[model samples]
Structure formats: C-alpha cells, structure tokens
Target: MAELESPRVMSKLISFLSSLLQRVAESNDLNRRLQPQKISVFHGLTRPTISIENYLDRILKYANCSPSCFIVSYIYLDRFTQRQPALPINSFNVHRLLITSVMVAAKFMDDMYYNNAYYAKVGGISTAEMNFLEVDFLFGLGFHLNVTPTTFHTYCSYLQREMLMQPPTINSAESSLCMGKSSKLHLCFNDDESSHQQQQQQQLAV
Candidate 1:
C-alpha cells in the first residue's frame, strides 16, 4: 500500500488523469462540431466552466487526503459510472463527480476526514449542495466502499498500463511500466491464504 502512495505513483496518476480530462474535453468539442445543427441540451445542464487541471490541482492542494484516497476515489468513480450508466463522466458533471468521489473515498478509507462543510469549502460548493451530492453519490455507488488490497492494486496496475500505452512525453513511460511490474509482483507476493483470511477479517471489521 505504501508503494501505491509513493510520489512516483502519485505523479503518474496526476498525468494520467490530466490526459483523460484532455481527451474528454476534445471529445466534447468533436461532438459539438458534429452536431452543430442540434442544440446540445445535456439534461438542461451546462458543462462545467472550470478547467479540469485547475480543479484537480485545487483538490490535491486543499483536500489534504492521502494519495491512496485519490486512487480509491478513482475506483469509486468507475463503480459509480458502471452502476449509474446515465451519469457518465463527461465535461458537464465530471468536476462534481470528482469532488464527491474524493470526499467519499477519504471518509471511507481514512481514519480522519473533513466533514461535508469543509469539503464543500474545498470543492467550491455550499454545504447543503455538498451534502446532497454526497448522498446521491453514495446511492449511485450502492454504498459499496470496501476496497480490498487486491482490488486496490489491480486498479493501480490498470492505471499504470494506461499510462504506458499513452505516448511518452515526460519520460513517464519507463516509470509507469516499472510501477505496473512492481504491482504485479506485489500481488503475487500477497496471494496467500493468510493474506486472504486477513482481508476477510478486515472486511468484517469494517
């Protein structure tokens, strides 16, 4: 787990997310271009005006959550989208979703976490709205927040692979590959009956 929280891992995650947001932004542009005749009415909602990189940086600075919290938040985002297909991660709702997921993951995975009011301040929303988003996001995820270590590492490995598949711009390709290899080795090392039993005990305790 410590390996997942390392600076290298965090940097790669940030880069991967930046790339993802860029792709989303580009896709939105393409859609708008292709559908120029039709008024793009996204459930009567406007896309978020803030830049994704800036919003992510704000969360990284003020959320004060562990790196693992962000990783777990990514996992929750995946689950949320899978469970709630109508609420896809696009420009319109990605910012709110990101903030809500991070807040929920911090609360579930960390012993110490800020309340909704504090998260609202960090996320630039009102406390009441934050509360609403929290409740809605929890239901969207079906309240499933228990992430086993194996699942955690598996997500990390996927992110690493994604980073590797992208073109190397900042010399992250080698590091991402190394991280993927390391996570696979770690998974193998932890694949034992004792570790499985321990995880079950931890789940029950949760």
Candidate 2:
C-alpha cells in the first residue's frame, strides 16, 4: 500500500494496466474482424479515434478515485467479457467500456465518486448514454460487485508479473493472449441491501 502511494509506482501501475488492456482489445478486435459478431449496446457506429492508453490516462487524470480502482475496473472488464461473450472489448467500444468499468469500480470501491453526468463528460459521452451503460454493465455483471482479498491479490500479482515481463510502456505489444470467454455471469438481481453492504465492506477491508 505504501509503495502504491508513490508517484513513480502509480505511473508504472497505470502504464502496465493501459498496456495490458490495449493489447487485449487489439487481439480481440482482430479475432472479432476474422469472425464478425453481432453488435451489442456497447458497440459504436464508428470506432473512437483515441487510443486506449490515452483514454485510460485521461480517466486517471479526471477520475480522482484511488489507484486500486484501476485494478477493480480491469476485473470488471474481464467479468463483463466473460459474461457477455458476444460483446468482447474491441477498438469500436473499448473506450466506452474502459470509462464504464472505471466509473462503476469507483462507485463500488470508493467512499465518494463523481456522478453520472461528470463521468459522462469525462468519458466523452452523454449523461443518458452513461446512465444506460452503467445499468447495462451492472446488470451484465449480475451486480456481483464484490471482490475478495484473495481475488484482488491474484489480479495484482498477475499485473506485476506481466509488468516484469513486458516493458513499462503503455504501448507495449506483449500481453495476455486471450481473455477467457467460456462461462456467463448469472444475470439476476435481489433487493438485498444487507448483502450488498456486506459485500462492499468486505471489499473495502481488502
């Protein structure tokens, strides 16, 4: 935790995350192009001009959530892809996905965060689209917003290992070959506030 507070370590962390996501999105896009897939709500009519690295850096700049949110956002993205196999991350929708994941992660993990309007502006989308994406993403994850300490550590370890293997540059080509795409997250919601609070507290403790 102390090391993570250092500016240099934080920069490196962001670099590793952006690099990993960029590579994964590029690989998925290539695979998606080879076999055209059905368009989902996440897809845009045209791919955004911004690069994933720049988009992420912009989020880090404007969204003042803790650095840990980035890791949680990555987890959310992985879960989203696993659940919504038809809507894999690609250049066409990666920017929106990144913003949604980060914003959702901030809401789940942080004590305070920007509202949909602010996040929408930060994401280069409208408030209505941001709201729509939030609901869709939460529903897609089945509102399974909790992350256990073990799971968190596992992801952190994975990122650290990848960082060691690849250069600390967001433009690196090396990354996980493919994101897993087998199972679907159960898409059900229960109005259980106690359970939700417990999950949030557990994640906060971690």
**Which residues of candidate 2, in runs, are more than 4 Å off?**
167-206
Alpha carbon deviation, residue 197, candidate 2 (Å)? 1.2
What is every candidate's alpha-carbon RMSD to the true fold?
8.9, 7.0
- For candidate 1, write residues 1-206 as lDDT tens digits: 35666767676677677666555445544454343322211211676677777788788878878888887887787676556544445566677878898988888776666778888887777888888888888888787777788778876776677677873232211111112334421112222212221111111110
Tell me how far the alpha carbon of residue 128 in candidate 1 is from the true structure, in angstroms, after superposition: 0.7
lDDT against the true structure, per candidate, is 0.63, 0.71
TM-score of 2: 0.80
Model 2: per-residue Cα lDDT over 1-206, one tens digit each: 33666678778888776776666667666777465566766789998888777888889989888888887888788777667777767777788888999989998888877788888888999989999999999998888788766567766776676667865332222222232232121212222233346213222210
Cα lDDT of candidate 2 equals 0.71
Q: Which stretches of candidate 1 lie over 4 Å from their true place?
A: 1-4, 25-45, 167-206
| Candidate that would win on TM-score | 2
Candidate 1 TM-score, true structure as reference: 0.70
lDDT (C-alpha) at residue 55 in model 2: 84
Per-residue lDDT for 172 in model 1?
18
